[model samples]
Target: MLTPMLASLLPLLLLCRISFCQYSSDQCSWKGSGLTHEGHTRDVEQVYLRCSQGSLEWLYPTGAIIVNLRPNTISPVAARLSVCIKPSTDSSGTNIYLDRNGKLRLLLREQDQAQGKVHCFSIQEGALFIEAIPHMDIRRRITAFQYELVSDRLRVEAESLSAPCQPCSNTDMLLAVCTSDFVARGSIKKVDQEEDHSSVTVELSRLYRQKIQVFVSGGVRVRSWTGHINMPLQCGVRSGEGEFLFTGTVRFGEAWMGCAPRYKDFLRLYHEAQLQGNNPCQVDTD
Candidate 1:
């Protein structure tokens, strides 16, 4: 009892479903490329890596996410170098990335910034390879970072250090590198936070600092806290910790402190509010 026209559109509709499925799983593996485990200098190399999902399921519905070391077999088992997949293709035509423990990791879309679009995709095509940048300092070093299209290619880069010279004992070396890549679009996101005189803080923190996707949905409301005149901000609840995490400084009533109009735009804040609404925004730590 199926009409020819309806049947013809089935495949297209199915593909669309696969393309928009919002998925996440907690799982990771070692995806680095170095032999030395000496955490002395900027030459430090990661034996393992962690990743989240970042693409829509299209033709295959499922794709393989590989996380191998830069020079496979150079580091030790404790270094932990591997990759994992949730096999979304098997279930929904999309292969979701997972951690070693089989947990879900979230991949984020890059926002507009000084570094440009760190994580954004147009056509959703091809495999991506990322590079590594040495850390500026050991204390404030970048443990891991996602990559984006520099000009022509997608890249992921890790920041670590090598062993320092004899003169510097505890100082880190600027040699080792951390890098990870998966199939699909390449990108990154930065952690942005806002604070006020009353100690009101809005922090956007993620498991992986580089992979935060920005999504916008209809009916999302945003506002600012500091009440600036320019790009005011909007306030919202974080999903996990239930904290006040403002997006861009938009306008709250009148001040341009921060604002996020849509739920998806403020997904992180919504997530936090859902889980920790009971906790006062002034005292919560997470």
Candidate 2:
């Protein structure tokens, strides 16, 4: 009872439906690092092991476990992630010490049915950035701290958008991007000079709303200067056997401020001690 025209249209409609589904799935997979699809209904097996998700296997110095997966359908997707752990918590707290190189590995395998697609996605990938960590070694009552310097500093940024099609008049658009930089440095120290003449310097520069805060006491003193043009600021602390000096220079847009009250008190104490010929160096944990 069916007409030839209707029969022909049925196949075309089915094909269009399949194409739509395929396109939707492909778009979703773009947000993921790895995606595998099985044209059939059989299960698929695969292995994944690495430090962080979305990480390339060859780049990992430490190996991970071989994973055997039974994807519910035919193909399955998986991603390896790489993460860096720091031995020290904060720049002021951690001793920069490096051990023969440290590394870690992890493995993940799917236990359920493996006939479908395996999707390897990472929510944290777009936010990944490099950070500094302090390395330290302690023996008996003595301690030494060292800073591990990272040569490469990378930052990630992302944005989202939504819009509707229109012929005229009505229009709307919204966009935002987040950015951050890794602070890489080779050395950081604080001490007083008496028998050895040493000096320290610290500097920082940012937008008008940004400000740098420094804390000093006893044998420590600080000095600062501002520049006319926008530039990165710098601060440093130097120590010797008899005295210690802290200086900071801020460079930014034409308008800037260089006065920090609490830091001035520290410098005052250091200089006052020098005028009195007294060693202002005192070791105290705060």
Candidate 3:
């Protein structure tokens, strides 16, 4: 009762329909369940996420899912981008892996998800392959994480573990001003020591440039700006320290200290460079 052509087309059409129902397109965040066909299908679905940052949640684990994350706009750093994922403290039910051409490398195991640690890999490494860990009861299991795409320059030794703590040379200071996310003349007002890093409160006398308004303007009365930046505890940054020419990177909406030097030292270096016409960029030192 059926022609050969119709029978072959039937399977293809059904596959397309199933795929459409499985994933959302062009989404920055994704939320879905692992329940599948016949309630035991162990099917693998493809998820496409286009954004620099987002979150994913999967409930009722059963099968697997491949998450494809790529930038929406092409940029020079696109090729150098890395993916960072912070697993939720309670996330479970799946083992995460990297999938390239079907070859898989484990990224996270099920038991480790509860640790809520952040993991990173290059974008070129592959899509995220999250496979459900087999369990009899699928009722209470879920996997969730927040992800961010960042350039290599922006993705340094996070939490100040390997963050550069040495004083920037005269040349590096000049260059940092030209390329850093924020530059200002400031002083440490308070330093809160943490296990691995120190949180520094800064009062900026002059803000040269900033990627965003991370520093709150003190207005006419206060006549300056104030903000916070994190530094490696080993840096020994302390409150009441003398003024500094501050520079650093802002990651995930938080500022991280970079090549900060004594304001007096920077003034001397800057003046010498200006006299020599070797300064990378002009700054109003007044």
**TM-scores of the models, in the order given:** 0.19, 0.14, 0.78
The regions of model 1 sitting more than 4 angstroms off are 1-31, 36-117, 131-143, 146-286
How well is each residue in 54-173 modelled by candidate 2, as lDDT tens digits? Answer: 221111111111121111232222222212221111112111111111211111111111211112213223221111111243211111111111112210100000112122110100
User: Which digits, one per residue and each the tens of the lDDT, describe model 1 over residues 1-286?
Assistant: 2224323433433453346422223223323222222322112111222233222212211112223212223335323322211122122211112222222233321111112112332212322211122224322211123321111222111010111212211111100001111001111122234442111223233211111223222223532111112121232323243332232211111112222223232344435544765322221224
Q: Give each model's whole-structure lDDT.
A: 0.24, 0.21, 0.78
Model 2 worst lDDT run, 10 consecutive residues: 169-178
RMSD of each: 23.5, 23.7, 7.1
Q: Which model is ahead, 1 or 3, in terms of TM-score?
A: 3
- The whole-model C-alpha lDDT of candidate 3 against the native structure comes to 0.78
State the lDDT at 46 in candidate 1. Answer: 15
Pairs that collide, model 3: none
* Clash count, one per candidate: 90, 66, 0
Error of 1 at 120 (Å): 1.3
Residue runs of model 3 more than 4 Å from their true location after superposition:
1-21, 35-41, 59-62, 74-77, 111-118, 135-142, 157-164, 219-221
- Best candidate per lDDT, number? 3
Look at candidate 1 and tell me the lDDT of residue 144.
27
